[model samples]
Target: MLELRPNCECCGRDLPPASVEAMICTFECTFCADCVAGPLGGVRPNCGGEFVRRPVRPAAALARHPASTVRVFNPAGCGQAEAAR
Candidate 1:
């Protein structure tokens, strides 16, 4: 099951369960679309993998399978990603 992470790993932006802006790598490293297109350049910083849009869990299903509350933020990593780009 996808963790459906709650925020952008790079920017720390809030990404609720249904946000269209959420993008994730195969390892489920979450980031916002802006971060992916900008600093990340569509590549995951932690894993050298491309990103894809994160699926929005159905509203009803979210109740049973809650989105993760834990956030993964790495401002320094985002800076490194920009430099690598």
Candidate 2:
């Protein structure tokens, strides 16, 4: 199942379960469309794959499937190198 990440990986924008702005790579690396298309504070995740939209979690089912708190963004300064390029 999709992690339904709570925020945009690149911008830290809050992405509630119903957000359509959340996009994910095959590896489940999440980012906003702006970050996917534009320079995200200088990081383009090196996921080595393309991104797809994250499926929304049914609100009522959340209790059965708790959300993951694992946040996956580029490692701090390293992202800038991607943006600089």
Candidate 3:
């Protein structure tokens, strides 16, 4: 199961489970619409991949698959910077 992170690592913006604003890459690197559409300009994140919208976990299954308050991710460029050297 994806850790389904709650914020954009760059901006530290909240991305709630049901949020329509959630964007993710194949690795499920989460970002907000604002980040991609505005400053980031649809650039692939630290994972070196494009992003897509995160799926909403159904409310009926809420208890069965509870929402996470914990954010699971590292910022972009950390690995890329190291790889460059």
Candidate 4:
């Protein structure tokens, strides 16, 4: 199951469970669309992998399997990735 992380790892933007803006790499590193398209340039910093739009869990299913509450903000990593780009 997808963790459906609650925020963008780079910019700290909120991404709720049903957010269409959520993107995730294979390792489930989550980021907002703005971060991916702008600073991060569609590449995941940690794993150097591509991102895909995160699938939204249905309302009823989300209730049964709650989305993650953890926020994995990493501004430094984002800066590093941008610099490397």
Best by lDDT: 4
Q: lDDT score, residue 42, model 4?
A: 79
Model 4 misplaced stretches (Cα beyond 4 Å):
none
Give the alpha-carbon lDDT of every model. Answer: 0.89, 0.67, 0.69, 0.90
lDDT of 3: 0.69
RMSD (Cα, Å) of model 3: 4.3
The residue pairs in collision within model 3 are: 24-52
Please give the lDDT score at residue 65 for candidate 3: 79
Best by TM-score: 4
Q: Ten consecutive residues with minimal summed lDDT in candidate 2?
A: 40-49
lDDT of 4 by residue, 30-81 (tens): 9999989988877887788999999999999999999999889888888656
> RMSD of each candidate?
1.1, 3.4, 4.3, 1.0
Better of 1 and 3 by TM-score: 1
The TM-scores, one per candidate, come to: 0.92, 0.71, 0.72, 0.93
Better of 1 and 3 by lDDT: 1
By lDDT: ranked, best first: 4, 1, 3, 2
lDDT (tens digit, per residue) of candidate 1 on 1-85: 9999999988799999999999999999899999999987777777789999999999999999999999888877886667775
Per-structure clash totals for the candidates: 0, 0, 1, 0
Model 1: colliding residue pairs? none
